[model samples]
Target: MSIPTTAFLALALQSQAAAPAPAVAPGTIAVEVAEDASAFDRLFTDAVTRALSDARFVPLPLESHSRYIARVTVTRTESGAVTAKAKEPPAMAALGQVFVPLPSGKSQIRGLVSTDLSVDILLRGGDTPVWSGRASTVQVEGSAADAPAAVATKLASALMRQFPRRDPVSVP
Candidate 1:
């Protein structure tokens, strides 16, 4: 090949390598949140439903059937590492102790709850998940972050942001 033609082919290949993976075809998806008989189940279900809708996914009722199933699971830890800092609530403004500066020049804030939220999409009758994503963080204490509704909304939104997309295609 001529030098110019070879360079053109190399540039085209590089651009293709940098492109993101194609998202799963838009279609109906059944959303189901593992029930623990608590208010959180309902809140998470509603949050997931809203997020799916926002992502252009047709979330089906639990009783209905669909080819894709989005399963949500929540795991709350009794305590987690306090490595990351969180923002304090308005009520704590008067305390003037919201953030503690560390020797490393990082500020640390108190957290009331730490949880892990995950969503796994699977094909019907499939044993392995086709796509999965997880969100984990310690919510700021005394702030809106501690509210269950807020937590559900935040986690669901974060998790679904990358939904329906297969892992990136690595160029050899």
Candidate 2:
């Protein structure tokens, strides 16, 4: 450990083994679907383009990331209940013990359906938000078309857990 600190520690370990390995910003990622949304918005854009291409992030096809945009809106709520009366015959009284007439109960009817999906994701630089959000799910057994691929796999696992992992290189 003398010759100029061993040649500066072998040139800082050969520049940390010839750097270059922190590039998770592939490019392109646009998706817009809201034209009278339905059909599970193409299965939630094919499960968020296969979970952002399996986390490799690179799905810009909507005219080439329109313009650094990321918007996803999906609202769903379905309810059901049918039994509008199944027996009716009760409208009298009964006192001093005598006066029958009571049998009219059994009716249930509930309904409420809603579906809205508006997603527009296009990012190629500028106005950086890379991942907007808006997901809701509530179905009481109605329209079970994979429920938009389970809400696009929970919004692509919450935008891949807020993507931001690429910083570990310091050897000088």
Candidate 3:
């Protein structure tokens, strides 16, 4: 190539390398928290949707444009960690059922109820994932009634720690 063309190409390549990667703009996302009872509870879809909205991810109807898409799955389980070793008469069964005791003689049980949540952000009509994250938490079973909302709040907050985008990508 001529000297001028070579220099111009070199500068262009340098700038391209130095430029920061593009990120998903703060815009609407067609979020779908499936009501998959077999995978989790029925309330998870609503909880996740609400949490994403609270995090400022505009929840657009599924019929919107070629924007972003967010799919999340949340689960809460009776980890059965803190059960009593001897099944004789269930001493402190309430606490035992809620908190799994340590396997050591001092306490031999599981630890606590565990909640796990995961999220996937994808570009519309694409098989590749733009961003994804997973978070888990353990809490006493006393709040079982509110566990749905509580876990949702925690998972959503954790996923949104980076918010909008967990990783950067160049838009087409």
Question: Quick one: best TM-score, which candidate?
Answer: 1
Candidate 2 lDDT for residue 110: 41
Q: Could you estimate the TM-score for every candidate? A: 0.61, 0.28, 0.56
Model 1 Cα lDDT, one tens digit per residue, 83-119? 4533433221233756543344444745456767777
- Where is model 3 more than 4 Å wrong at Cα? 1-22, 35-42, 77-80, 83-111, 142-146, 164-172
Greater-TM-score candidate between 1 and 2: 1
Over 112-169, each residue of candidate 2 has an lDDT whose tens digit, in order, gives: 4444443434345555443443434333333343345665676555554445442221
Instruction: List per-candidate RMSD values in Å.
Output: 10.5, 13.3, 8.9
lDDT (CA) for every model shown? Answer: 0.69, 0.53, 0.63
Best by lDDT: 1
Q: Which stretches of candidate 2 lie over 4 Å from their true place?
A: 5-11, 18-20, 29-45, 50-58, 61-148, 155-157, 166-172
